[model samples]
Target: MSAHSVPAPLPCPAAIRLHCAGPLEAVVVAALQRACFPEDPWDDASVATLTAPPTGFAVIALDGQEQPVGFAMARVTAEDAEILAIGVLPQARRGGIGRCLVEAVAAGSHGRGATALFLEVAEDNQEAWTLYKVCGFFSVGRRPGYYRRRDGRVAALVLRRNLDGA
Candidate 1:
């Protein structure tokens, strides 16, 4: 089997739900991180920090089986919110999970009075860049060598969206 063929593509039902992350959700979140980004999976401490109040937000997307297949994490202040991380298990990609996660975060941030949201994507991550653009984010700047790769090279692109108008 191929590396991405572990989880079969499950039909996304209309009943899918998004919920706030809690301590009990850590394991699922870790699983998602491992599946989506094993090279830089979040540690327990980091997940704990992201689920804490005031400084951060984390949302999980649960399928009909009540299994988590997607997630998004963000950090927010009075005026701005930053998408700290987001991912969907390989089988879950291209099925609207990522969009749902982004929308969930955007709604939460808007409710908290954030006027804008920002995120940094790897320069080579064209798929993610396209997704963010479709979600109303636009290139605001670039940070050369912002992301360190396993092979020692670095590249990054900064993107932002105005929550009020977008």
Candidate 2:
């Protein structure tokens, strides 16, 4: 498959598996960050620290080869769960990887007793906004200058999803 083209579905029933990330998955997680966000990418150390446990949860979705195609990370507090970051590799885009990752993260958060989930997205990223909406997120607010774009513009949008029904 081309670098930017989504591959055909794997012969094995495509399953999005979630796991409690650890040091071993740092490299793949870092790669996913880089592919998803060209403006900024998480380093291996950051990935390891975030996945360390207690404070956060890092989950990954793998292809048939066990390659990390997407991932989602979130931090849970007493009252709410904040989705820290989520992205799918460029080659895996539009193949339901992002949705799978979000579902996994939401499930994990709900299991931990979190009632609501929140996240911020770049204002211009309509694709992400659409996905979040489909996943039951609603625009609650916006943060001025939340993200700096490559063209030197700053924009932001706040979205929240209620996990009560999930």
Candidate 3:
């Protein structure tokens, strides 16, 4: 992929608008994050700090009504970028919002001179794992017992996607 391109196979749905969230929008993004991942919520202040500027940035997905529905936070360092967090509301799942957020982050990271984008997903999260795979990400590593589940713990699959045509 080039810096100006989003993954060709995954396009943003017409009804959804993707906005690059500034620091001022951290609170709203935090709320959406909480709604999407009630089990692991980041406070507004933390969200703000994580997505401040320069190496850090966020992309928010809005519905046609202009309501925040999903978000992706990422940071670029050297030639690599990592997705700090990403989620879409339960009501908005399976509608291509998550894929849009991933592509947005990937494009943003590429713009910032990143060669690869990385993220970790719980091994048991088939939905997200499948999405990443479809987005052209491949598992490069794994961390055992990385996620605390209600039943026990699950491993985290560390996935990566090349962004600079590397």
Candidate 4:
């Protein structure tokens, strides 16, 4: 494949499995976060804190081999839920892992009585933006200089998806 070309999606994308993650899996989730976001990795303790029970929850995506490949963390407050973070390992990208994780988080949020799910993506992240758009998310707001990059800072586009039908 060309350097800029993405690999074709896995033939059996369904092989990817998803499971709810709790404090017990915080270490695994932290490792995935670090692998996916080397520039800003969260430690195990922080992951546990963010994905604590009640208002917060997290999902872990496992490959067919049952190896953790991705994770998504979210929190629900009242009728609103926000995705705090999500990541799929670089080696596992373009294979529907990210989409699966997003769907899992949305479903979990809805199960928690959330009417809407929200997430923020860096404006320059075209791949993630497209994924969210395809997942029924729409831009609702923007925060300037929200994401710190090696070059500088990038604006964050806040996107929301209604979970009323979820």
Candidate 5:
């Protein structure tokens, strides 16, 4: 792949396995989170919380070589769920990995009895906004200056979607 090439954005959910993330994956998940969210990242403990079995759920996407490429984490409580974090390496994006990670989270959460999913995204992050919208999320509210950046604060757009269809 060239430095400037963005692979065709095609849904290849079948080719990837959404493995349940566990304690063993914490090290990798933490690194991916930090690389993807330099401004605000989660630690190893936070990533390991997903393996607690009752409240949180996480999935790691691995390529054909069994290398981690992306992940999604969420919290589920009965009929409600909230996304905590998600990321795909810069080189692996535009290949629908992010979207698949989200779908995996939704499907897994729904299987665990969650019907609605909630999340917040920085308003200025158009890439994430577009991804959420495409995944069936809609803006339900906004928190002004909710995210702090080195330069300034950014608003957080609260997004929600029904996972019943996923």
Candidate 6:
């Protein structure tokens, strides 16, 4: 995609707004992140710290009412980028918000000179795994017991995709 090209919108039942979150939206994005990943959410301080770095950026998805329903954050360095976190509220699941957020990241990363993007997802998160696959990411590695949970440790699958034509 060209540096100024608009990110493609995901097909879904409801309309969703996607935008790059700035320093002013840090607190709101942190709250949305916590709502989506209650198991291990980043604190407001962490969100502020991550989003302020030169290499870091955030994408937030909002519903019709302008409420945050999902968010994705990533860091890019030179020709590579890594998705740090992405989450959609339970109420917004399967509505295409998550996919849109991912696309936003991919487009933004491509614009920043990143040739590829990587992300690690909990092994048991079938929905997310499927989403990534549909979005062109392929599994490249796995880390055992990477996520600590109340029941037991869950593995994390690393996925990567080239953004040559994103």
Model 5 TM: 0.87
Regions of candidate 2 where Cα sits further than 4 Å from its true position: 1-16
On lDDT, the leading prediction is 3
Candidate 1, residue 76: how far the Cα is off, in Å: 1.0
Worst 10 residues of 4 by lDDT: 3-12
Residues 42-76, model 4: lDDT tens digits? 99999999999898888887788988888889999
Worst 10 residues of 2 by lDDT: 4-13
Name model 3 segments beyond 4 Å from true.
Answer: 1-10
lDDT of 1 by residue, 1-166 (tens): 3321112133334646777775456677767777888887778776877767877877888787978888878878998999988998888788777877887788788777899999999989989999998888998998888876888756778889998874
How far is 64's C-alpha from truth in model 6 (Å)?
A: 0.9
Candidate 3, 165: how far from true, in Å? Answer: 1.3
Superior candidate under TM-score, 5 versus 6: 6
The lDDT of each candidate is 0.78, 0.77, 0.88, 0.86, 0.81, 0.84
Candidate 2 has an lDDT of 0.77
TM-score of 3: 0.93
2 or 6, which is superior by TM-score?
A: 6
Structural similarity to truth (TM-score) of each candidate: 0.86, 0.85, 0.93, 0.90, 0.87, 0.90
Candidate 6: tens digits of C-alpha lDDT, residues 1-166:
3342236445533567676775667898899888887888788888877877578888887788877788888889999999999999898898787788888888888889899999999999998999999999999999999999999999999999998865
Give one digit per residue, the lDDT tens place, for model 3 in 43-141: 999999999888899988879998888889999998999999999999899999998999889888988999999999999999999999999999999
- Scored by lDDT, model 3 comes in at 0.88
lDDT at 145 for candidate 2?
Answer: 83
TM-score-best of 1 and 5: 5
Q: TM-score for model 1?
A: 0.86
RMSD of 5: 6.4
Candidate 6: clashing pairs of residues: 1-166
- Highest TM-score among the candidates is held by which one? 3
lDDT of 2 at 38: 70
